[model samples]
Target chain A: MKLSLSSSPHQRVKRDTGQVMRMVIYAMIPGMIAQSLFFGWGMLIQSVIAVISALVFEGLILYLRNRPIERTLTDYSAVLTGLLIAISIPPTLPWWMTVTGVFFAIAVAKQVYGGLGFNIFNPAMIAYVVLLISFPAAMSLWLPPTTHAGITPSFFDSFSLIFTGFTTSGYDVTQLKTIADGVTMATPLDTLKTGLTQGVTYSESLTKPIFDGGFFEAAGAGWGIVSIAYLLGGLYLWKTRIISWHIPGGMLISVFVCASLLHLVNADYYASPLFHLFNGAVMVGAFFIATDPVSASTTPKGRIIFGAAIGFWIVIIRTFGGYPDAVAFAVIIMNMAVPLIDYYTRPRVYGKNADKGRGKY
Target chain B: MTDFRDLSLQGLWKNNPALVQLLGLCPLLAVTATFINGLGLGLATMLVLIGSNVTVSLVRNLVRNEIRIPVFVMIIAAFVTIIQLIMNAFTYELYLALGIFIPLIVTNCAIIGRAEAFASKNGPLASAYDGLMMGLGFTAVLVILGGMREILGAGTLLAGADRLFGPIAENWTVVLFSTENPFLLAVLPPGAFLGMGLLIAIKNIIDAKIAAQQTVTTEKAARVRVTAES
Candidate 1:
């Protein structure tokens, strides 16, 4: 005699945490490569430092918490968190800073909140905000893209600068940021904001040598290629069905709409939609950071609301607020509202019409 | 003896005004930004608690039940106003620093809680004792929170000691580390909430450990009794 167990649905989605985390890690490769290619290979060193510290911290925390260390290590969530933080930070960030950030991300942000799925905020973003707030100068230290900086940090120089704060030839990280005109180049968004604040028009700001690029003009120096790479990775995640399209689609469209409206109203005051979309962390934030399943709105309609609000916040904060780029602030602020969004945007019961969710008769 | 011990224990740990009872959180969180600020506010609160407790207990028998709360509140307000005036006269710097909080201490739930719960029922001596212990307990938490926020936020301990102690204290500030970057987040209001949370978590851990030890000792006693019976 044979016994059989059958169900209506015969297929199952691949629901392994380790596998999903591995996919995310795999997806970030193109973006990381693009960042290295443009910014310098210091991103590579930061990633390595972060990953090592993250694994050690994760393992140590798991040991202290009396959990299975081997099982948790296999999950690769720590690696992914470290990777995200590494990419989000300035590549020339000190090695110790990387260690500190990863420790906060893994031990405080992730493990303290009871690990991966239970974390209330995006662990990477929390550490990013902490570092940005605590060490503003170091956090804003972005190198000019290699094409503009006229001198890229070789692997050894990048290595020495990251670990020892100076290169082989005794050049400092700040020196690496200088161009031929003796000006320490700033990020495109920062340049634009500073210029506009100084009463320069949008076109006048773009004329700065920092904005000189063949294909990267729409984006900042290295940031344009980096953003494109992140967009590609994000699209890959969408294609593989690893992530849903609602978040990035809603975020990008809303950003475009908001920027277009403000730009139309006052061309000199607001940057164009294209500028807002391509510059700084907007591309990466919409596609990668805001789409974290645990912290983001889970409901379909809620996701749209969450994404659109973040987009609106990014634009509002960037144009009028003190900060130049506001992706981290916008994401964290919207994360606090995810619960409210999800509660209101709940899907109706199977037998009930969607009107029930809206409290309509 | 047991009554005083129990009252002291309740004030210090079991029904702690700051940690356990969670009373007077307004001042507990607000003035705890620095050790001196916390210490000053704490002393002021303690003095008011003792004053109100003693006065309320002495007048408890004469007051009507319905009118007692208003009377207790009035007593607390009077003590707070006197303390405010004394602080303004003597520690003028601290008075300015802790401006609204001193007056606001009149509304501190800890003072009225004692007046309503303990002072109204007990003798003046026990009420005074309760007030002292509760005040000390509250002061300890504020100092701890303040010290923690001070150290983490600014990498200093007992900073601004001159504000509370006097001219000699101007040089009493303890420096643990120095940095140019403003650890501004830790000095902000959010730091108060974080510090309070950590303090509460620590209190809970101590509570759980005490409970566990008590259970183990009682089990040992029971086992000894069983063995003796056998």
Candidate 2:
């Protein structure tokens, strides 16, 4: 054989699964810190629990399926799923519930669909929604941010509450939800939604004590700060080319256009565009969850359509539907439409005159 | 004798109506929230199937080819009406529980399917046997699916047994465990789909195991004959 001068590794491929996954995990760091700082140590503890369980389940399933275990674990998809599930849930969720969500995320959502890239739905969102639907009472138990509540539990107390559903001081999660004024502490979006449903105007809903500490009337105290943190992290992801801008751009534009129109029509009924953007999971979802490479649409045009539709659904569901925050439902719904969107949005080949939307001859 | 065994096997497993053919899925998913409800609907469906099958088989030679479908539908409809009236008069609670589904049995493609594909070409005895076996197969799935939904969703078995088996069976409800939050998903329609998907996955796993075993035998045949000689 003739001597070859080719160097090893042939060539380095950019954006491998592991690299992309690492980037995603890195992007979530600032957001996670913000969530824990504002919410408490509950999310951090839950994240630890979820990541551990997710890895365990992932390893177990791979072993059962008789595959290379190390290769799958190093991908960090499980870690990201754990991270997403951890942050998305209410802080006061019980330990076993977080474990249940992780189990469902890895075992059913990922493994049963042939694992990782083959999954049909976003595993974390599916697990979150399943937990939400299954345990509505526990899923809705959010402790107000430390800034608003003024009652800080030590790290150990947060751990005890999450693990045992009670603090060492004998106060349960429900007790933690009630502020000093005897009113239950709800998520800013939840409080606003409830107030509006009770026939309060948009501006009046903002006048409640929950919004008392905010510089603006759009988002609740501590929530807007968290959203801004996520937005900064999301922009970093975009700048690094880890995530494309088509989805986020489409989503924000649609939300802004839709919210402003509705607000212009009847400002009494609709929240302003700024409020909609900063509140709930709007920023995080537009940046992180909706941009999930596996479940999101791949084509350029399909991406825009997919993101716009999710934004549209978020507004409709939040304003009229039963739920207060709707990013999970909206993203899952758009995930279902990915195939049809991709089918219709297939790009035309050069010098080809075919007009079939299905990309078939 | 082989034909009889084949028919039985086809109905019970090989060609199960609910699991394989996926016929009459509405009642299969709807009424399968409880075991007794499944049994109630299953028995009613079996009665209609047997009656319609026998009648269709007996009159197969006389009906004209062009109007055969309409004639078969009419016969099934007649039996369904009789079954409905009998259910109304006797088991009123179950009748009410099963309600439109009992009347809706006339639309079950399994009954008409057997009438057209099997009974119309077979003798009355075979047709009746086919009906009995197929109906039992469907009932078995419904019963199993119902059992899953009930046990998982409500933490109880036969919770509504009295609807079918009378007041004496009311005490048969067994609480698996007491929990303030019953897995409402299992009793909900989504639970039915999830349970069904799991079942299908289980069947596929079994099939794969059997296939793997078959392949293992062939591999074993090629084993080197060491026998302390190598």
Candidate 3:
């Protein structure tokens, strides 16, 4: 009479979806602070726009689907998606474009595929790719880090630029990007790719003002610090067991290996492994985007394969492909292969030898 | 003979080649970037369908069953060639714009599918009617999908109309809005696929609504019957 009649063994993780998402958002704060200090307040403005629009779209879809809007919105998945997209894009992107991206991410990419868990690809990345392909000019308009530019755009200036495509003083993003030499500053990756394409060696390309800290010191001036902050966030995620070590571990190792091999072959042509690790969105992508529990490989061994393949593709695409950054493309490509990866890497049942033939039974 | 009304409904909505049967998607997706391109291709395919259906029906008995596929294909190929020649002579610009697709129409599954399924069994006149209706269904889908893509991709409607019609039709192009930066995704192959998918989804929604209404009416009638009996 005293024995409880529950169906199965009962053990549960105390953290809910909302709690886990909150932790992720907290982890991103360090990186966000770093990004703001270096890239200006445009990122913060973009994040606000994205989050509001994302929440609105999420609410609308939940209402249409006859689901509980408040409870689902509390989970903060849409907020995280909005944050990811906000951080990934050029901060000077117009408000309408940011809203368009958030709409597609929440309404089309997430809800159309039956909401958060059922989505096949990362919604934030899909939105980024869509915006990038649709408006190539706007997508690549990055402001030089404030540390190098010697002028951090005021919050009002960034807000005005995002809304009206110009600051109150009427300086456009293009004009702002112009450095002391009148050469328009670009991202470190963009400068590197352009240099290499124009027949400049890797070392020669690093001599550009964007890599002011020296060739081997860091990826680029502010980029390296922002990447380190993200790495710290990622390590926190790993230590807290919020994300397993397999995906990020495999990704970092493979990126190092691939970049090392190429660097060894021709030091002048290929950048070092540290450069690859700290440059662009590679760190954020490896730790945050690719570690998405829904889209990424689930099996222990499959996660390694998934992460490693993504790293390899990132190097290949960044070096040889048209786009300077390859994180979104690589993640989306690997998302398509998750089903196959899972099928082959299934864990063996207890008392059944995986190497033994099934016919022996 | 099948009722003309029933055949029209089947062709236009119930058993649409592009939306339901999903046949001839190669041409449907490939050439639908502009309205004129779609209209030109649709007309050519319709003509080819009509000719092949009538021809297949006429020779239904002479060709043996075992080799019927080869015979049907030959008839379809001949019609495609005739249409190709006509377009080449009349609409040279549009013809060139469509490029390899006109010849590739011979490989379109919808034409051969109708010939084998409907034409080979029906009389010549009935087969021709079916061919026309089916062709109309396929063409409607192509035009709609093309219009969707063109408007979104380029912000214009009936663009390149002069290539389809004559010089007077040049002004027929309607400018919805002009943008320096066009939505390139809508102009690409992926846009064609997404447009096609949305069209099919819309058709299914309409069909489902009609079915639901019919069920509601039937249920009301049954409830009245039970009330009367009680």
Candidate 4:
């Protein structure tokens, strides 16, 4: 084969920050579509509100900081962050809350910490945590997926509910939470947590209607499909080399291992591995959120350890902690550990002692 | 010895314990949830500062250098107890509201810092003035932070004023607005931190502006008659 003269990096992919960010946004479309289909149109509405507000806030902050607003905004990182936030929050969250969350994500969480790559914690997760803490009542008001709910809000209804806190047909999110069977429904993780707290066995809790008639037996209705879509999108990213497999791979394996070990010890108290994998934010979190390059572990080995730790915390917190979903909390906690992980897991240099190497390596 | 004017200026503006020196942050952050709570704690802290400063200055000559720290702490503890007892008697609700922080005033670094740095080398009158001015500075910050948090978190100012003042101040709460959900983050401990950071930033900005103005004037003054006017 004929060789062309080039230094070091012989193979190059024609991709910049804007391209990578666009790819990530493209990858998230599947998850967004699934979310909107399963939940009402509220997810789409919330996403639009979040993305617009995120761009506005990001631009404002950039302008105030005397940086190039157009170039940074074009990178689409803010859009992805806003989308991730919209996915994580309850679809029926009020519009103003979505705006406020986006503002905090862009301005305080991202810009205040020196913007984009310099942010220590993932801005989306920080905004999610802040919104979760600040508005617990509104944040928890999730509706049953359209499959179970008797009345699915139309696009107009979703828009109306977000803007005015009531649907066009005069139904509030709480009222819309009622399923066809006249029982108000929470998410599967929430249902399981509440059941476990009330001394109901895990197996008995699985028999709840939220879990009984789902498409997947292990994961509940709509959520399992949504998770599967995210997994497919994640697989695409993996195939395209947009993300490495270590972080997601380690996170999934560790989650399965932890849940299985606990489930094996006592089937009645603990949920199975599949439930842990396909429910909550595990699929999305492991693939998309935990793989955030800025706040995640940099070295390959460190990435694995970081992912595994987050996985363990997810299972632990979801099972024992007060919160039903653990992904946002888990990701934020792991982000704090990334620098330490990267520092200790630095790769050894060639022609140098691995143990003693400190300077460039 | 420093003049009263210089001492007052240093204590109040130049060398603020809460903002500049960053001393006694534990009480500054913890008890400043409302204006009344902050005011109550600030007053108690000021009393301890004054009492300890006066006492430490009086005994500065007798106490050996090796044992001065212990002596200063003991004096501060005594004053803290005195303030605690007084608050318990007159403002029992406020005392209960403050709880452990009243006794914790003894641990406030600003008190012992003044004792060791200022009172030990200064006359009683100067030390007393320093204490009063420093106390006022610390109290001003507490009041500002507390008021900011209260207005943001609860949409009211001087809420529960009766806790600090007598029952006659029951209606002192000025409601700025009412909402179903006030910003809960502002009431939390993290809010205290963010508010404190903002206050520090504001102070720095003001200082920078003053420095810039002074430089411009000095530059004008330093302009010599290099070229005699044509």
Q: DockQ scores for all the models shown?
A: 0.65, 0.50, 0.89, 0.76
In model 1, where do residues sit more than 4 Å from their true spots? A1-8, A168-180, A214-218, A352-361, B223-230
Looking at model 3 chain A, which ten-residue stretch has the lowest summed lDDT?
Answer: A352-361
Residue pairs with backbone overlap in model 3:
none
Q: How many backbone clashes does candidate 3 have?
A: 0
The reply for model 3, stretches above 4 Å from the true place, is A1-12, A214-218, A353-361, B223-230
Sort all candidates by TM-score, best to worst. Answer: 4, 3, 1, 2
Q: Which residue pairs of candidate 1 clash?
A: none
Error of 4 at B54 (Å): 1.0
Model 4 DockQ vs. reference: 0.76
User: TM-score of candidate 2's chain B against its reference?
Assistant: 0.90
Model 3 agreement with the true structure over A116-205: per-residue lDDT tens digits:
899999999999988989888889999998867745579999999999888888888888889446877899889888888889999998
How much lDDT does each candidate structure score?
A: 0.88, 0.87, 0.91, 0.90
> Which ten-residue region of model 4 chain A has the weakest summed lDDT?
A352-361
TM-score of 1: 0.92
DockQ of model 2, rounded to 2 decimals: 0.50
Looking at model 1 chain A, report the run of 10 residues with the lowest lDDT sum.
A214-223
lDDT of 1 by residue, A265-338 (tens): 98887888988998888888987889998899999999999999999999999999887889989999999999
Which candidate comes out best when scored by DockQ?
A: 3
